[model samples]
Target: MLEPIGQATAAAQNIWGDATQWGVGTGVGTVSGGFEFPSVEEIDAVLSSWRARQASIAQRGNTLELMVSSLTQQPAEDDATTGYIATWAQSLTQLRDQHRSMLEYIEDYIKKLEAAKQAKQAGEAENEAAVQKTAGDLAQ
Candidate 1:
């Protein structure tokens, strides 16, 4: 009975080891199948697309900031002379609120992008460390 149990355990271990090996092989094959270096033209196209998007966002934000600043800086037109002054005041308030909201959104987006970039960098570092460890083990 003990001998049979030992054989079963060994069989189970062998099955588990084989499964692990196959899983690793499948993962490597999948990654290699998908991996390709982008041509310089493709790289430039992607970079230009991103740069244009960045520039557009920056220009919009700057325009909003400038409008808000200009509105806030101007002296109030005398209310007694014209109710246009009151209307201007109300419009200025709305503009300020919109600008503030947009600025907040831009700030949040920047922070999120930074966090994602940092996470990618950290993951690459971890992968490098793992590769180095495997290389050292193989050397020994």
Candidate 2:
């Protein structure tokens, strides 16, 4: 009977590797350096930072939404000052909606990065196992 070897495919996107320092920026678990493939740790760190930022931005969006909700209840008087405040509220609403959309993008990208890492790590392990099995079978 052939025994199944372990696979590390789940660790494919672990880009941070053994590096002591990570670069500054939002990395989506992909090799942004082009010249060098990032370690899983590096990618994970970036994702974590991005998620934290997203949460913060989401809270800001909620606050903006609340401001819009409250300000919209007031009647826009004919005076320029009142109209300007109303316009500001409307702009805040637009900004909040945009932030929501941006959050979706960040979430989707993070998922992709995780999957990629897994596939890569697993694939490599799978190949190595196959090679070892073949050699063992030949020796048997």
Candidate 3:
């Protein structure tokens, strides 16, 4: 019934609220002003968490799709019932799309995190090389 769909919509809103809590990194690899970039391992862990969240969104989307399918497949006996079913289906479809959007957002964030991790590692290697070069010059 429409009541159950209403409950599902509330659940989706909670999931979206949780998604907004994630802090997108501020200028990945920016070393100015002493911004401490996360370590590669730390980034990896964050990426893992985001991936898990993405999976959860995907699962919720699947559920919404199933509900929509069930509502749409039912044979409505009257104009009133048809109208109610149509409304429920429309709402569920929109919620499912929102879930898909969240999944995409999380995926994009994961890619950015991976890129930042790589950049940080590269910077560390460059710093180490410079230190060794300076030390060698001093030894001569």
Candidate 4:
């Protein structure tokens, strides 16, 4: 029950990391030296993959919620039942941690994407100005 939830959460985190890297770019070193921009197609592919992962995680979460509700209603009297409940709680905690981390990763990636877009726009504007200047000089 909870085990599946934990696994799904971990999968979500991995998917988030991969999608963010593909969308915004990733590197070590200085920002100016190591920066790399992925093509629009690559970013779109990654976004699609992330959406699929999100759907899977939501399904797992729904299943886990149902199991948890069922378990909660059950009368736990034996040692085995107690142990099972303990294990389920642990798995739930792990799942929550993974989900939180994935959300943070998504937020960070969004910020990175916005910065990249702004930089790209500025560069295009500069190039356009340069071309205009060159054309004017040629006309003279």
My TM-score estimates for the predictions, one after another, are 0.45, 0.58, 0.70, 0.58
Model 4, which residues run further than 4 Å from truth? Answer: 1-32, 38-71
In model 1, which runs have C-alpha deviations exceeding 4 angstroms? 1-81
**For each candidate, what is the lDDT?**
0.57, 0.68, 0.76, 0.63
Ranking by lDDT: 3, 2, 4, 1
Which parts of model 2 are misplaced by more than 4 Å?
1-39, 75-78, 134-140
Model 3 lDDT per residue over 27-140, tens place: 545544333455778878887888888888788887787787788465758988888888888888888888888888888888878887788888789889999999999999
Best by TM-score: 3
Query: Candidate 2 or 4, higher TM-score?
Result: 2
List the candidates ranked by TM-score, beginning with the highest: 3, 2, 4, 1
- Against the true structure, candidate 1 reaches a TM-score of 0.45
Question: Candidate 2 lDDT, tens digit per residue, 51-87?
Answer: 8987887788777777777775656566886878868
Give the true-structure RMSD of model 3: 10.2
Candidate 3 off by > 4 Å: 1-36
Per-model RMSD to reference: 18.0, 13.7, 10.2, 10.0
